[model samples]
Target chain A: MAEEKKRIQAYLEQLKNKVETQENYGGEITNEEARMDIRDCPECGAGRAYHKGLTACAYCGFVFMDTKLTDGVNIRKENNS
Target chain B: MSGNPLLEPIHGITLEDYGAACARLGSGLSEDDVAKALGVELPVWQEANLLWPERMKQDATFHIVTLFGQYFGQADQHPKFSGLKASASPEGAGNIEKIKQDKDFYQELEVARQVAYDYGLDGAQWIVDNYGIPIGDFQIAASLWNDQIHRDIQADYAGYNQRQAAYQAKYQQLFAEKQGGNVADDIEF
Candidate 1:
């Protein structure tokens, strides 16, 4: 278990360095973090995460890209199984 | 297969629009890749959609629904979709329609419906068969008639192989007739 922890730590460090050095940088610090942010709309507090590139909105019938992620407060712990 | 425009109405989108929609759906693919797969210039595709919207609409919708159902079943399961009417096929009755009434079916069919509209009969069937829908379900059968149509298309391939064998035998007979008394050492094509 200790050896596994050390290996994971080393791997994360490598990922950080790669992200910093890459010229055409994309994605945020971590997918997990970005996913948390995109789970709900940035403007209104709506919970629609997946966008279909359509004009009409399903909830509140809002017709804009203002939808935000909705479940950050209740984020379940990641089971590393 | 169902050429009834009234039953399977066009979405007022041209070939160009259809291509653009397909590109939008295939956001991860490169532009060149899209061109090779769709076989059309971006502008021409747009114009074709504007002109002959009916030509491919039924096929595209069918496909989009299939994709949506697949995506829904495996990845995302939307709870709100349960409220909407689930009947998308003519023969959908009792438990068949009940099965479709679930949110997964709605999501799946939405993806497949677009496919049917864009790729027409073949595309529609491709989505249905790839999704591996069970046979004898009416709503599944109705929304996915292209599956049957596709099987019909494959029948020609099976028929052709059988005919080719018969032709080969006939050719051998003709060769024997031409060289009835020829020695085993003499033969030509």
Candidate 2:
């Protein structure tokens, strides 16, 4: 029975290790949390808000992303050009 | 932790059935609504609702099986329930060709992808041996899934974090002021 208990403890430790070591694991809860969103231009310190007919930053003309925006259920097909 | 024993089915509602009913409750339906749907009286359903969660707290399998019951519950739905239903407009029906969106396939793919990512080639080899998905296809899906997840996080996280920060800061300030107002009556110095 004690051997089983030891094995279970080892398994629990393994589980704990697996969780704590994950890429997204945050050890502490805080008001200030890490984020991945790039809302501002790194080059010119300008807000990188969306602009119609443009994929780049409006202020600095910095290329934000290369993804092609497509017309959705609500957006018209004419906007795709 | 107090050890929880698995309770026998109350009013012919199996643990899987209870799990499914809990899933229904999770999606905004009330306990009474779930009980009516399960064709059982409220008090019996109430007892079941309490006991099942207690078991889940003790037995890890109970939680996992409950989650599985949430996803797989739709496929293996209880006899009393009328599972998923959808309505389509006639206008789109003629023009739009049907595309298959097999959720189970994607769920399984995700599981395999995570295994492959965590264990590298050995995990991919396991998928190849046990599951029938081609390695190339699995890799491609994993890449696509990662890109999508990254894009989704980028689109939403900052705004969500900002809102959360605002709420927390407000609450913390209030809490600090409240702490200051507390009377220290037990001073024996």
Candidate 3:
């Protein structure tokens, strides 16, 4: 049992230094790869935030990035609010 | 073999065993190491590894075995193996307390997962990098909320891997349009 704990600790330490994700599917999907617009609103300079369903500027009503909100695997409109 | 060899355990190694073996493989253990630990020859282990996924593809029911695979892969307490653990979920990977406080984050992760796959990216790893929620940990947490939903998620992985060739082709084409990437997507000026 002690040996198992030590091995787990060592393995986790190794993972902390290296993230071994699937490589055959190409590289990590950066925001540009997803075409995600995460820029602050040029109009009001407010950070982009996803609230209710819209992903626009929090303070100003600037819509930079938005997706069609639907009842998904976890996210639900009724329950979250 | 069992009633149906097609669905039977590979070389008498149960599906849970194969899942744990894979977890150990992901943990940087060599193929020979896993084969030895599992008390099988390297060639036999290799054959099982190859055929197991092929079986997943051929699984007519699709999700049943694979869902359990996902869970077993992360379950350190799984009965099949001792002193061998391959779960990649860090200590903070899935915090129940955090899940209770902000369910939105989890929901948003689900949404991100969908979008990443839509863009032909590996949805599991994408969420891991972006939200710090590994798929293994996600499986456990989501299972707590609802088992059926968790099954659907695992089933999607089986479907996705089969269709990944087509998806990767599209992603490569689309990604070529963009410049290089920054690991962290920062504000664009």
In order, the candidates keep a fraction of the true contacts of 0.00, 0.00, 0.04
**What are the per-residue Cα lDDT tens digits for candidate 3 across B77-183?**
55544565444355443442354245444554555566555544567766655555545445444544455445655879676455444555544444323322222
Across B36-123, the per-residue lDDT of candidate 1 in tens digits comes to 3344333333443343333335455575444433333321122222222322334333434444455434334444444333322233
A4-65 per-residue lDDT for model 1 (tens digits): 56655755565566445533311234445433223333346575533433222345555442
Calculate the i-RMS of every candidate, to one decimal place. Answer: 25.1, 25.5, 23.8
Q: After superposition, how far is residue B182 of candidate 2 from its true place, in Å?
A: 38
lDDT (Cα, tens digit) per residue for candidate 2, span B63-113: 544443443234224564445212224532221111113333443444544
DockQ, per model, reads 0.01, 0.01, 0.02
- Model 3, A21-81: lDDT tens digits are 4452224556744344345578898664455333345566665322222232343333221
Q: What are the clashing pairs of model 3?
A: none
CA error at residue A69 for candidate 3, angstroms: 51
The DockQ value obtained for model 2 is: 0.01
Top candidate by TM-score: 3
TM-score of each model's chain B:
0.20, 0.37, 0.49
User: What residue runs in model 2 are displaced by over 4 Å at the alpha carbon?
Assistant: A1-81, B1-7, B60-72, B83-189
Model 1 spans with C-alpha error above 4 angstroms:
A1-5, A17-81, B2-11, B14-17, B24-189
Better of 1 and 2 by lDDT: 2
